[model samples]
Target: MSHADPDQLTLVALGEPAADRSTSDHVRGCAACRAELASLREVVALGRESHVELDLPMPSEAVWDRITAEVDRKNTTVVAVPPHRPRRRVRGLLAVAAAAAVIGAASAVVVDRAATSTPVAAEQLLARAQLSRLGTAPGGARGTVRVVRTGDHAVMRVAVDGMPAPQGLYQVWLYDGVDTMIPLGVLTGGEVEVPVPAKVDLTRFKVVDVSAQRLGQQEHGVSVLRGELG
Candidate 1:
């Protein structure tokens, strides 16, 4: 009936099996959703490409041991890597090969400024907000927001936990807590990077709100979480 769920489309694109069977069927029949899926796949491809185009040598085993120890530590959430099992390949190999051509007694490095640029300097954190659960939100709902300046643009990097899947999609917004509410973008899953509206003044629309909205529904729906920007 309605277009495939955005979150499910992202999961499918990321090599994780679909959570709902209807989403797959809808994607097969709906050209719009299929195109959206393709676009998400491109983003994932670019992330993998960035990792691939690194001109560096593999780190020693001891170096990897240190990384593992950090991951084992508590109270740390690793956002750099996607949680999907199959996508681990991309996260596992970062600057560990791909763009490097090793030779005897010398390391030949070839950095593609074009390919690896997105994941480097473009990711600059501007602000952060710790989202608080709303009255309508689930009991264990929690979210984190990071306003990251990506190259010329700024985006809201939102990550949530214990959030139930919405009937349609979850959308991020900058609410002024009065009249104006600017829609950023559709949130694909537990985490998404939504492009903030251009020329937005955070002083006005300083509240980051995540809402569960139905397909093609105008105006806001049930509020899941909200956080004030600092």
Candidate 2:
């Protein structure tokens, strides 16, 4: 007997009636048709079992605004390249290689911007402070801090000048009026924006501190620059 058509086997695997008696008889007797039907049935069953429904929560307006702004910035910088015409073999290969290089560079720039772009929108300035020298910091070491509240969270934008590069890294911290000091994030010299956790109350953790930290040392490190939110 001849093997059954794939369509007929699919129907039989799905428990639907086959097209005719010949296809049905072929499916019953042919080992190939039976194996194919079994595989199709297993796939169908797995697909049905794996289907899931979920209600995803939407990001806040501030988050959306930041995303829109970054997208706009990227779109503004993008240069549209027109399609090139076909040429001689050697020239065509060179043109393709040049085009690939240009595309790769453009992709790198976009990815860099996306990674470095600030996540929070700087809508309202909550507080400003001039960072004063602390601990073993040089007399010339000075910085400026600006705290902005965007949507449900706040961010501290810090600019440090006249300070020598540290041995390890510069870390930003928020200090409550009491003894509690919360590490916000790491700073990358010049100007760096550090995100404040939503659970942290800005009113309570009003002090902004920049610390010179060693690689493995965790606790507070050594405060190099200190400033109050007000």
In terms of TM-score, the best-performing candidate is 1
Task: Provide TM-scores for the models.
Answer: 0.49, 0.46
Off by over 4 Å in 2: 1-122
Residue range with the least summed lDDT across 10 consecutive positions in model 1: 96-105
Which residue pairs show backbone clashes in model 1?
Answer: none
Candidate 1 similarity to native, TM-score: 0.49
Tens-place lDDT per residue, model 1, 77-117, is 53232233222333333332222212211221335454556
CA RMSD (A), model 2: 20.6
Candidate 2 lDDT, 151-201, residue by residue in tens: 877788999997888899889888985899998788885679888787877
Flag regions of model 1 displaced more than 4 Å: 1-119
lDDT of 1: 0.69
lDDT of all predictions: 0.69, 0.68
